[model samples]
Target: MATDIPSPDARPARSGRRSGDSTTRTDILVAARTLFGENGFTKTSMRAIAAEAGVDVALVSYHFGNKRGLFSAVMEIPGDPVLRVTTAAAGPREDLGRRLITTFITLWENDDTGVALRAMLRSAVNDEGAATAFGDFASGAMMPAIATTTGLSTETVRAIGSCIFGLAVMRYLIRAEAFTALTTDDVIEQFGPRLQAIVDADT
Candidate 1:
């Protein structure tokens, strides 16, 4: 069954300035991130963000032009994942796994990236459009490139992608004790080789 997708304009209450002023813009982004992370993108609204940031609704339009733009800003992710993956995947196939894992971890460890990811995940759960956005990013950016570089099948590549998503969910969102507390090095040491195996699998 098709679900009702929440518009960005339908969000809950927020705590700050209105949207257009420099301070308000910054405030809106910050509030939007928190709400988006907590409630999923579909459920978050420009009105709520404006309220949270103490700004007017029109200012949101003036500053971001729309909810998607606000989402992009909150995510803080660079160009589309496809471009990012293509650029990052430009080395020897054998080194692709390690490089990918390393780069991904580094990006996630950053506070901004972590918050962005949280928002993305939340959005994915509530909105098909958001899920499509994420899928395009994963497929166009990461999976195909990994498959091409490492000669893995599409399914295998997707499995590796699943692993990455699972890891993030367990470690960050769920805060699984061991996964959460592990030092970055500990995680890489344990999961890196497994990810490589998936990428280089015989299937």
Candidate 2:
């Protein structure tokens, strides 16, 4: 009879590989985000992301199709707040502020949203196209609805938009310790009325 035994390192190596595939995908995204933030979308390439991630170029395409798709995935956040707010606002003008703030806060509390938000802030700082896209999404979709509900002029609506976006920046992007550390209820308490004030302001 003959007995064979695997090396001590073999089991650990195999165990590491059990999650290697998924970890590779995550690595690609992280590398992509860093590259995109540093170089902007136009200059950052699939090849570069793969190189940074230490993965094959084919893996990038296989997972995300192209740069745009990969960027979209990297930018995806939890809760479709844009859609939800638009849908909810379609029915009536009243209750818009509360609903919008509630939805926005709920979404921001999630990990996915935090990841997307960090990417968005970095991209906006580095990429002109990303800044334009973010601005358009805010003014076209969110601001107009809030303006309609509150009967504010476009300029006032935009001012309110700035305030809301500023809060996100201060809290998340800048990681203003005070703002970031605030509990959900504390955030609502501090900003809820102010947000309502913006919506209800006469301009």
Candidate 3:
């Protein structure tokens, strides 16, 4: 009789999963992305996202590990954005705008995460909730880092962020004739100094 036992510890965890987990995970991602876009990661709560997704906070934690992890999962960011900005911030202060804008645009244009972001932005235009979310992340999360990196004040950052947002909406989202007529390089040349001025003002 001593030869017949397998411990619970020895069992595979995956064997215990319900078929509904896939749907739950997707639900969590959708809800988290919306909340994060609207309120930013620092302000959105796991409980709030879970409640929006019709799940428990425990399930959200189990799926994404933590708030930071949830944000990364929602955005499909390759690395922590703070670190990404810090690394990109390293070099001449003069080149900061070009570097930052180029990097930011590249991420939004990439095939993998960019595709998801594009779809989300399209949805955002027609939906108030989506627009709130997009606005929150862009102004709250994205601008702060650029402000820090450029030694600019928060107010200046907001000004710079507005310019970038307009560029994004015109070029990528709305496909406005004015922005679309200019090449990426042309935009960078024309607008990069406007961004650089915020940093220059600080110095």
Q: What's the CA error at residue 47 for candidate 2, in Å?
A: 27
Output the number of the lDDT-best candidate: 3
| Per-residue lDDT over 1-203 for candidate 1, one digit per residue giving the tens place of the 0 to 100 score | 01123354555444443335557778778877766666565456677777667767777778776765676666555434444555666777666667767766776787766677676677766766556545554554457766776667889878878887888888767779978888878777777788777666655
In the range 1-203, model 2's lDDT, one tens digit per residue, is: 01012222211211122223868889878876666555555456677677667776678878876665676666564344355556644544445556556666766776767677667777776776566545554555557766565566888667656766787888877889988898887777777677666666654
| Per-structure clash totals for the candidates | 14, 0, 2
TM-score of 1: 0.57
Cα lDDT of model 3 overall? 0.67
TM-score of each: 0.57, 0.55, 0.69
Deviating ranges (above 4 Å) for candidate 2: 1-74, 77-81, 88-95, 149-151
Query: Poorest 10 consecutive residues of model 2 by lDDT?
Result: 1-10
Task: For residues 66-177, write the lDDT of model 3, one tens digit per residue.
Answer: 7666776665555566667657666798877777677667666678756765666576688776567556666666677766776777887777667766787888898899
Local distance difference test, per candidate?
A: 0.67, 0.63, 0.67
- Cα lDDT of candidate 1 equals 0.67
